[model samples]
Target: MTALTLAAAQTLSIAGDVPANIQRHLTFMRAAAEQGVQLLVFPELSLTGYEPALAAELAIAPEDAVLSPLREMARELRLTAVVGMPVRLAPEVGVLIGALVLGADGSLAVYTKQHLHPGEEAAFIAGQGGEALEWGDDRIALAVCADFSHSSHPRNAAESGANIYAACVLISEGGYAADTALLQAYAAEHRMIVLMANHGGPTGGWTCAGQSAIWDTNGLIAAASGIGEALVIAHREGGRWTGRQVEI
Candidate 1:
């Protein structure tokens, strides 16, 4: 069996700043690559921050100018990256919160969030497509923030044979500890590894809980940032679990 090295990045996102946000993500990407991680996951709406109102104004087409550089970087760095962006759709229903996948060769695969948060309903549409990605022995599924709260989303992912579910979340401080416990239970019940990247600092008057974590299939909190900006890495070797932290 092949052991996978995965990095869950916790950082701050600037509201409505696509260029700077991409740069911030890339900085972490390079660091992860240098550390020899095969996969790097970032937070939801990381490129535009968590301002639902401002996301409407900042959302761009899938082929936007700013994202090209990220695509190029993913290819150059030979890393599989999951990034967040607001993607413009046809017929003016406006944008959707999309998890953009840039493969090692610059190919693109997008997964939109099916479950929308209260505020997001006004700014974006729920995605109608159900999709997952294949990487080595891992069946990867993508979820954004609130999507994981509903059992239906993870159920679909698990039913689709996903060995690992990656979530890009912008979790606020209020109910974070409770949410973490919830995620752990989900991971254990489903027998799948759950990796999440959450934002740090204050954005749009909301303070995010930066406790990025990776839960093993048995639901043990194998690796965690605990609090603040850090990289949480998890891997299993010879049926043994290991986790590490690296300050970014």
Candidate 2:
């Protein structure tokens, strides 16, 4: 395999605080860029936090004022980033769970989470969606939290020639271990690399698990973060991989 350095960032986003959240996430992106990482993945709903009720109240359009700093961060850092937030399709309309992709060149792509969990069905509209994207030499795929639980999500991406499945998850404290193991098994079975960034700290009415993780195609675990803000980096080459915990 060709050598590739991948990075995952665990971020803590306070509800309705867009600026602070962006700054926190950018801190990790800048650090990853300094370390020469090819890609940086952040937690789901890192931009606006995971408060669906608040999202309904403060939702911003895809072209809202909230994304200016993030766009600049991606270009300045020269690293691709995937960050999640709620997108208000229109002022009078409903919001959707969206993963916004920022390229090193300042281009953008949006992937809305199509699979909604039980109560979520009442809050957001499901995306008119499909599979993830193929970015440059990396065949990349994406999903929010619940989307990954379904076999079809990963299976479709792998079938479509995606080599890496990047997931932005908002994991509760209790479900961390089991979810991670299941995701690992999914990646190994599909023969694709898996990268997941999860929200941490107490936000809204819930506390999220902070075990951001990365697993290679060979069923080998690459890197994982503890319960806090962290940067995890890994490199793969010739079917062999190695990773270590490093400060950002």
Candidate 3:
């Protein structure tokens, strides 16, 4: 069987600037492709920062033309990328925190945040989460910022046959410890590999803790990044896991 490479894109998003953030995401995708990464995940609200106040004004449809560049890049590089955005399914429907999957084969899929953070309800609404991504023999599940806060989320994913759990988040320094502990515990309890993508800089007035990381099935750290723009990668080959950090 071929090896699988997964990466977390720890990047800084420009506040309410979709164009600039798209460019930044493309850069990260290129870097990840060079490393032979098959799947790359970005932080929550990566396209527009974590600005809840501006989410409504900045929200767009999943099929917006603005994402053409990123989608094309993913198809060209043969890499599947999960990017965060605020999505509006309709004019009357409230905006949702969305994770768009740009498939290497040029397919598009959307996963909305099933749970909202305390204050996020004012700007965004809970959505029905999407299905797991099937890649080769792997079943990968996705989670948003606050979804993993509930133990039931990961539990359900594992019970549904997911071997990999990826979460896109915007964790601040203050909540880093508890949040990571919970993720680590989930990894151990579920016996699933866990990947967390976090912001590399401050966003939405919160000081971000940019230590994006990946844990093995045993909950041991496979790879982790420090406080800056970087890529945390985990490689699984011949049933063994190895990792590295790349500055972007």
TM per candidate: 0.93, 0.92, 0.98
Q: How much does candidate 1 score in TM-score?
A: 0.93
Model 3, span 1-248: residue lDDT tens: 45999999999999999999999999999999999999999999999999999999999899999899999999999999999999998889999999999999999999999999888899999989999999888899999989999999999999999999999999999999999999998888999899999999999999999999998756656545468899999999998888889999
Better of 1 and 2 by TM-score: 1
Runs of candidate 1 with Cα error greater than 4 angstroms are 221-227
What's the true lDDT of residue 127 in model 2?
A: 73
Residue 236 displacement in candidate 1 (angstroms):
3.4
The better candidate by lDDT, 1 or 2, is 1
Worst 10 residues of 2 by lDDT: 128-137
**Model 2, residue pairs in steric clash:** none
Candidate 2 displacement at residue 194 in angstroms: 0.7
Off by over 4 Å in 3: none
lDDT of 1 by residue, 99-201 (tens): 8888887778888888898876888889854368788777988888888989888888888899788899988889698878877877888888888888867
- Winner on lDDT (2 vs 3): 3
> Order of candidates by lDDT, top first?
3, 1, 2
